[model samples]
Target chain A: MNSRVVISNIVRWVLLFFVQVFLLRNIGFYNLSAPFIYVLFVLALPFGIPNLLLYILAFGTGIVMDAFYDTLGVHATACAVLAFVRISFISVTVNRDGFDEPEPSLSGMGFKWFVLYSLLCIFFHHLVVFFLEAFRLNEIGYTLVRCLLSCIFTLFLVLLAQFIFYKRKSR
Target chain B: MRNLWIFLNRYNAFFFLIIFFVAGIILTVRNNAYQRSVTLNSTNGLVGAAYEHLNVVKRYLNLGMVNDSLAKENALLKTEILALRSIDSAKDVTVKDTLRNVQYTYLPAKVIKNSFTLRNNIITINKGRLDGIEPDMAVISPQQGVIGLVRDVSDHLATIRSLLHKDTRISVAIKKNNALGSLIWGDRNFDIRKAFVTDIPNHVKMSVGDTIVTSGAGEFPIGVPVGRVRKTNVSTGDNFLAAEITLFNDFSNLQYVYVIKNKYAAEQKALELNSKNDE
Candidate 1:
C-alpha cells in the first residue's frame, strides 16, 4: 500500500476504535444488541492487501477491543474469523480486474454487494463473539438471539457510516 | 520435502488463522487468572483516563439523582449516630458485645466504567493499588448492598467483577432465619436487577419478601444487604432450595462504590492454611 492509503487506514482504525469503546460500548439494548462498529475497519480493507497482513490487522483490532471489554480472547478470536471469511468472500464475488478504486468501499462497490459483504462478515464475527462469550452449549438459543440481534445492529451502523463519510474517488 | 514446503506456504493464511484462534481460546479459558495481565484491561492507565473523562459528563447528568441518594443516606446515618450516642450516655446500664469489633473498612471510589450488558460484566473504579485496594476485596454500593469483588488492580485504577457476571457466586444468608445459600447470576436471561440464591437447605422455609444478606463466610462482613427474595422453589436433582432475588443496587447506573478491606483477613487466612496443613 502507498503512504497515503496506509496513513488513512491508520486514522480510520483509531477513529473507529474510539467510537466503538467510548460511545457504543454501553449502548446495548437490554443486554442483547450491541453494535460493533470497529469491525468496519477490517471489512473495508483493500482487496489487494496481503492475506497474512489482513489476519494480523484483524487480530490486532480485536485484541485492542478485548482489552477495553475485559474480554481478551473473545474479540480477537472473532476478528480472526472475520478476516478469514473476508478473504474467502472477496475472492468468490469480486473480479479484481473490474475495480478502479483500491479499496472495496461503498461507492466503489454497489449497495447490494457492499451490504451482502458486510452482512456475511459481521454475522460471522458476532456469532463467534456471542457464543465464545457465553461459553456454553445449554444456552445456545439465547446466544443465537444475541448474535443475530448484534449482527443487525452492527450491519446497520456500518452502512450508515459508509454512506455518511465514504467519498467517491476521483479519476 | 519441496512439495510439503510449497503446500505449507500456499495455505499459510489458514495456518495463521488457526494459530490466532487457538491463542484466543487460551486467553478466554485462562480468564480466571486474567488479572495477571493488568496492562491489558480497562484498568490500564490510558483506558482508565479515557473512561474517567467520559464519566465526568455522565456523572454530571446524574447529579440530581446522586444528590437525592446522598441526602437519604445522610439522614439514615444521622439517625444511627443519634441512637448510638443515646445508648452511650445511659451510665446505669452497660452494653458491650465481645463479638463486635471494627472488622471492615470502606474505601470510597468512583466508577469510571461499568458494564451490565455483557454476560461477564466488569466494573472499573477510580481507586487502585495506590489507594490500598487489591484483588478479591469485596465491593459494595454506596447505597448499602453488595456489588462485586475487586478482580484486578493497577497503579491508579482497578476492575471489579460485578455481581451480574456469570462467574460471580457469593455466599449469602436469609436474614429472618439465617438460611445460608450462594448468590448467583442468571442462567438464560442476563438480568441486571436480579440474581438467584441457590444451595439453601431444603428444610429451611423461605417466603417472598424475606431479606438476604452476606453470610460473613466470605470477604464481605456479616449482614451486608444482598437482595430480597422475589420467588422461591425447590431445585430438582438436589435437596437445595433456590430463590429469585431483586438486588438492591442497580448495576446499570452505578456512580460510586466502596471497596471493603477486611482487617483480619490475612490472620484468618493464615490460621485456615495452618489448620489445612495439619489435616
Candidate 2:
C-alpha cells in the first residue's frame, strides 16, 4: 500500500525466489517431499490488494518457478489455483477478524487462522503441482502421498519463515 | 447487451482464472510432448549462470570424491593402453582397417544441477551449443557408465533427461546373452538406484546379477554398462519379461559427465529419412 510496504514485498519476493531455487530445490526428503517456500510470498500478500492484481502476481511468481524447475506451466497453474483459493478464503474469513490487519501473516492474523490459511493454500498448490507433473491416473496413490508430504514440508518452512521475520501484532 | 456486459464484468476474475489456467496447461502439455522451446528452461543463460556459480561451491565440497574417480579412470585407461600396445608390437599391420573411422567423440562437461528424487528428473550440464552439444547426444559418467541423453541446449548450458524420468526409454541388452530389452525408470518405484528392463523375450534365460549394457540402437554406443539384473520374473500383463535392475550410476552424486558426439549421426539420419520418404 505504502512505499515501505511495496519495497519490503519486492525484497521478500526476491529472497523467497532465491531460497526456493537455490536452497530448497536441492533439499528433498528421500525423493518424495520437496518444500516450496516461495508460495509464502503469494500467501502473505496484503489484504487490500485487488483480486486481479493478486492473480497476476501469483502467476508471475509461479511462471518463474516453472522456469527454474523446468516444469514450464506446472507451478504457474498451481499458483493460480493458490491465488483463487487465497482470495475466496480471505473474503470468507477476514471479515470476522476485522479489516484493520494489513496482511494475512501469522503475526497479523493470529496463529490458528494463519495455519489453516497456509495449510489449505499449500495443499491445493501441491495437489495441482504433483498431479500435473505426474499426469497419470494409474499412479494416483503415489502422487497423493507425494503431494501430502510436500504440503506438510512447505507449510513447516513457511511457518518457520514467518516466525523468524514477522513481528507480533500489537494489541 | 447491457446485461451481458455487466455479467461479463462481474465474472471477470473467473475468466482470468480460466485464461491463466488454460495457458499453464498448454505449456505443460507442449513440454510433455518434448517440443518446448528453450527460452523458459534452465538452459537459459541467466538460470544456467546461477546454477554454474552454485556448482562452484558444490564441486568444491565434493572435490575429493571427484579426484579419486578421475584417478581411478586414468589408471584403467593406462592398463588398456598398455595391453593394446603389447598386442600391436607382437604383429605388423598387413591390411587396412575399415572400422577405424571415428564414430563417437566425448566432450567433458560439469553438471550444474541434477535431480533424481522427482519422477521426471532432469540434469543440467555446463556445456551447450557453443561446445557442440545437441539434443539426443549420449551422456556417460566416468565411474558409473550410461547417464542420459541430452534433451535441450542453450548457448552455454544443456539439460539431460536422465534415466530416472518416466518418459525415458533406452535400448539395452543382457551382456552375457545379447537378449535385447528397453531400460526405463519409475515403473513401480521412485527409487533412484533402481530401474526396469522390459520387452525381453520370455524364452531368454535370465538370472539375478546378469549384466545389462547399452545395445547401441539408440543414443548410446554399444556395450556401455547400464545396470545389473536385481530381480527376475517381475509380473507384467504382457508376455514380455520385465526384470528389475540396479543402475550403476549413482545419480544422486553425479558431478561430471561426458557428452558423446556421434560424428556420423547426421549422415545416418539423412539415409534413414530417405527410405521413409520413399515409403
Candidate 3:
C-alpha cells in the first residue's frame, strides 16, 4: 500500500525484464533451453493483492517482454495464466490467516516453505508457457526436457532474488 | 447487466486469462503472410538496433575469422581475374566456358541484429537500399549457403526474413535428381525441414548427404546451397518423400553476408507476367 513498496515492485519488475530479455535469453544451454524468470515478478507480489490488479500487472509485464523479444502475445498469455493460478496455489499451500499477510516475503515464511511455494509457482508457469509456445504433443519428450531445464534456472533465480531482497529482520 | 458486470469483476482474472488465451490461438492460426510481415517490421527495428551494437562487439572479437574468410574470397576472385585476362589474350573461342560465371553479386554487410528466439525470426543487415539491396534479394554467406531474403529495405538498413522464420518457404530441389520440394520450418525442436514433394520417380535413389539447393523457381537463383539431406523417409498415404535438411549456414553465428542481385530478374519477371496474361 505504501508508495515505497510500489516503487520497489516497479523497479524489480523492470530489472527482471532487462535480465530476461538481454542476458538470460542468450544463455540457452542448448536449443531446447528457455528459462521464464519473469514469473518471479508475479510470485513476489503481496499475498493479499487484488486478483484483478495482479492479472493486469502480469499482462502488462508480459507485453513489455513480448515487445522486446518480438513474440506478439505468447508472454502475455503465459503471464496471465500464472497470475490467475497464483491465488489457488497460495490457498492450497498456506493457511487462510497466513494468506492475509501483508506481503509474500520469504522471511515471513520459513526457507523450506518459501522454496516449495516458489518452486510450485515457477513450475506451473514454465509448464503452461513452454507447452503453449511449442503447441505440439509430438515433441512431448523435448518439451518436457525444456520445461525441467527452465524450471531449474527459474527456481534458482527466483530464490536468489528473494534471499537477496527480503532480508530477515532480527526479532 | 449489473449482475454481469459484478460477476465479471469478481472473476476478472479468469476472464482476462481467457481473452489472452484466445488471442494467442488466433495469432497461431491466422498467421497470414501480411500479419507476419507486420510483426517482422515491428521487431526488426528493435532487434536491428540491439544486434547492430552486438555486431560491433562480435566483429571485433571475430576479426581473425572474418579476415580469414575475406582473404579466401579475395584469393578466389584474383584467380578468376587472372583466368579472364589469359583468355582475353589467347583467342580461344571455347574460353567463354573458362570465364567465371558470376550469377550473383556479393555485397559485404554485417548482421546488425538477429532474432531466433521468436516464432518469426528476422535479421537486420547494415546494407540497405543505399547499397543496392532491395526487397526479395537473396542474402547468403560466403559459403554460398542461403541465409534469408531481404524483406524490407530502408535507406541504410534492411530486414531479412531469416530461413528460421515459420512463414518462410523457399523452393528447393535435391541436387542429384533435381526433384523440387518446399523448404519449411517444422517448428519442432527449431529444425528447418522440407515437405510437399509429391512426384518423384521411385527409381530415383535418395541417399543421406545429398545436397539440397534452391530450385530457382522464384527470385532465388539455382545452386544456392540450402542444406544437406539429414534423413529421408517416405510419407504415409502420399508418394512424396519427406527430407529433414540440416541447414548449411549457421544462422546464430552469421556476421558478414552478400545480397544477391540477379541481372535478368526483371526480364524473367516480365516474361512470366506476359505468360500469365496470355493464359
Task: Count residue pairs with overlapping backbones in model 2.
Answer: 0
User: Best candidate, lDDT-wise?
Assistant: 2
lDDT of 1 by residue, A65-137 (tens): 9999999889999999998888888878878576566887788888898899999999999999988887657
Q: Of the candidates numbered 1 and 3, which has the greater TM-score value?
A: 1
When sorted by lDDT, best at the front, the candidate numbers are 2, 1, 3
- Regarding DockQ, does 1 or 3 come out ahead? 1
Candidate closest to the true structure, highest DockQ: 1
lDDT measured at residue B39 in model 1 versus the true structure, 0 to 100: 28
Query: Candidate 2: which pairs clash?
Result: none
Per-residue alpha-carbon lDDT of candidate 2 for residues A38-132, written as tens digits (9 for 90 to 100): 99999988888887899899998999999999888999999988988888788778784457778788877789999999999999999999988
Off by over 4 Å in 1: A96-99, A167-171, B32-279
Label model 3 with its docking quality class: incorrect
TM-score, A chain, model 1: 0.95
Q: Stretches of candidate 2 above 4 Å error? A: A96-98, A168-171, B34-279
Better candidate by TM-score, 2 or 3 = 2
Interface RMSD of 3: 4.4
Model 3 C-alpha RMSD to native: 22.4
Where does candidate 1 chain A have its weakest 10-residue lDDT segment? Answer: A162-171
